[model samples]
Target: MLFHFMSPLALSNSYFLAFRPREEKSQPRLSTPRFSSQRTLFLTENNQKKLPFFQARHHWMEDYKYLFKVVLVGNAGVGKTCLVRKFTQGIFPPGQSATIGVDFMIKTVKVGNDKIKLQIWDTAGQERFRSITQSYYRSAHAIVLVYDVSCQPSFDCLPEWLGEIESYANRRVLKILVGNKVDKGDEREVPERIGRDFSDVNHFDYFLETSALDATNVDQLFEQVATRLTNDMKITDERVHQYRADATNSSSNQGGPIKLIDRAQTQLNSCCSRQ
Candidate 1:
């Protein structure tokens, strides 16, 4: 029950409490109350007071650098480092040492009302460091599987990267397929259809052909990822309104969804009726 009490008190906005027994054999005692907000509040139920443990993460934003973790994975020499260098440090410097394990960088991108600070992990694309680099995949919210547009072997190996991620990465991770180094048609080996097929079968969020050497669609790609991630974090008004409506509807039908009773009064009534 929602009560506008004159005094300040803690409340569960639109939730109910459930009891779960502790499995420990030590104490001879009792069950603890667990808060569940799966149900809606009812206006008819009276004498309801707030029980602790209804916690919700509030929406707030600071610098976009701390909100999300994104990972980059693909074959060796697929321009993963070049793409990152172009975006974060500016200019894809040549003759640099290949990634030893995983390199990290930060970029803040705006998405609707929030700014998401993306912590991008560019994993080593070589076969040797797979063990070392694979651990980073577990924490990523989004994954970009890169393939060189000019290399069929790199494109063909895309499935292996995808398979690894499915086996061990974040279960809810969003994925995107990227074809890098599009500027070099002289060396181009993979066709556009290859990228499309990978995107379709794996349910990629988006696909783009980019030239990290020239900096193409690099910003747009990350922006889209940042936007999608921010959306995933939010509890929107639409969902809130729909949940309220569903609960209200459920409460009004036939027998009230769950018959709630005040424990003290229920015991008293049982005794009197028996007598």
Candidate 2:
């Protein structure tokens, strides 16, 4: 599995909470909820009102640095839905059923100091939805191919998934290999080494073994996706800026002599006409 060898970076940012759980009992019960056009007002014991953390910066909530579309594709019953729910909503759904067509969700996470909005597309694994799911790959910035560690058939189907991704997704798209259900240790079918080897041979960007049921590496999985994509985009933006700067500089440098020549030519014409 690929391990992040860089120095630790600030990856997660928690929202400011209005009240701490421990302080809730000591404070007087909130009463007569008041509202303002710009803030949410809640009255205190002395009749003074205060704004909640979120209410203070409600407009800033919509601001983000970038938006990336991440699509999850894997065989049926590989806990793809569970992974998305756990990462976005912090829930491991019980008795989860196979997806029908495709489910879409939006989540904003902080990477370093920039806010990134991820448009997660959880595609169904059934054959009927193959056409629909394939349509999503072309636009995806990242594609996470998941498999069940306890199911050999799911692990075996990875090559087929890779083929589809290569045919439909962007060539530079971030490809991640995930072995789900590591919590199923006793019933494990695919070895970790084998999965890692597959990921390496197939030139996947990253690989990890995650257990969505237990919330193992769930946050890390998505965090890596956000961080990697953000870094790539920043690099691209820098290159574009540099290219524009270079072009502008070249045009300005070339214009100096050309303008001088034009002015000299105009002066010569005036002199000749005067003579």
lDDT of 2 by residue, 1-275 (tens): 00111111111111100111122342221221111221321112112334455543442233566656788999999999899999988888899988878875667799999888776778889988898788777657789999999999999999999999999876767899999999999999999999999999999999999999999999999999989887766555444445445656777878842223454333322211111
Using TM-score as the measure, which candidate wins? 2
Per-model TM-score, in order, reads: 0.64, 0.72
> Native-vs-model 1 lDDT?
0.62
Runs with alpha carbons beyond 4 Å of true place in candidate 1:
1-61, 235-275
Runs of candidate 2 with Cα error greater than 4 angstroms are 1-62, 256-275
Task: List all candidate RMSDs to the true structure.
Answer: 17.5, 17.1
Scored by lDDT, model 2 comes in at 0.70
In model 2, how many backbone clashes occur? 0
- Model 2: what TM-score? 0.72
Q: Please report how far candidate 2 places residue 140 from its true position, in Å.
A: 0.4
At residue 249, give the lDDT of candidate 1: 74
Error of 2 at 58 (Å): 11
